[model samples]
Target: MMIDNRLCGSWDMISNDNFEGFMTALDIGFAVRKIAVLLHQKKVIEQVGDIYIVKTLSIFRNYIISFKLDQEFEEYTRGMDDRHCKSVVTWQGNKLVCTQEGEKKNRGWAHWIEDDKLYLELYCEGEVCKQVFKRINS
Candidate 1:
């Protein structure tokens, strides 16, 4: 359950691509989609031993996930899709890969550090939303 400690920091969104498409694939309503697309996001990742806390922050809403690596837990996408899913996160090489099992097909996300930038790929229903974040703290 060891992780790359370098990922523990504050990150600001640099670019988000195809986020609307990804939200549409999740069956998100138009109103929320519009608001979500307009807001920039910040991420704060903290780790202690094998436990990880990931916070996705924005003006409109925030989503947080806390769990130990490789441990299965119930995750409710409350402010987002409002779906209940069993989720587990584990490392695939240097990337932190999370697989969510529930109603949707191919639903998951992966975060990896590349060239000092935090890269995130959100997947659901064959749609992939790619987002990159730049470190904001020394």
Candidate 2:
């Protein structure tokens, strides 16, 4: 079977290994984080040529970002980093690699699949959060 790689997707946050060691990392309060933890995120990804727009939506909040592959652009991490930074994403061996440049060091993230399971790794401030998700059938 062949996979398009760019399509509407859904992910359930099975476990969040928030590297921040606390919910304050996003600058949100405990209550918000609690709700966020329970949030079921639906990802809508649209790619046309070298450009892509990805949206992460949930009842709690929604984040939308658009960028061109391998091109450097300014990104504002509204709900995540909450800062303006240079960002870029490219495909590396079937995995999507993203790098964010800003005040924080060692900041970047990657998404890939293994055994039909989706995985996400977020890094910042020398910390990393490993999250696992399982795809569901529509």
Candidate 3:
């Protein structure tokens, strides 16, 4: 199955829940966590054939990750959290599910679009962070 092209665009974060817990699980420092929680995050997704480039942009920092479907790649969570992970993204129905293998257990994220909003379910260890983004530009 292919990822819905509707997911390609720029989305602005509207709500974030349990993000602090998720950041703590990643061992983020207290100062960084505080700054991170306050920043408005934006997600930009670009799809070309089977390759996908996903970028998370914020005033404090930006994270850009690129990968092809079903292929594993080395992912470095640089500015967000300093972690090295082996990550693979695949399509599950219309949702983009990513599995991350590294020091943290149960680390992954799923992205799906519902109505006019984009949803992201980020999980690490036992903590789950839910973020909702509204379409800003397409």
lDDT winner among the candidates?
1
Q: Who wins the TM-score comparison?
A: 1
* lDDT of each residue in 8-73, candidate 1, tens digit only: 899999999999999999999999999999999999999866689999999899999998988899
Q: What tens-digit string does per-residue lDDT give for candidate 3 at 46-78?
A: 987778999999988999999988989999999
Pairs with backbone N, CA or C atoms under 3 Å apart (clashes), candidate 3: none
Worst 10 residues of 2 by lDDT: 1-10
Reference-based lDDT, each prediction: 0.94, 0.71, 0.92
lDDT of 2 by residue, 1-138 (tens): 222363336656566687344345445566667777676676555666667777777787899988777889999988864788899888777677789888777677787877777777877766677877766566
lDDT of 2 at 53: 74
Which is the better candidate, 1 or 3, if ranked by lDDT? 1
**Backbone clashes (count) for model 3:** 0
| Model 2 TM | 0.78
Worst 10 residues of 3 by lDDT: 1-10
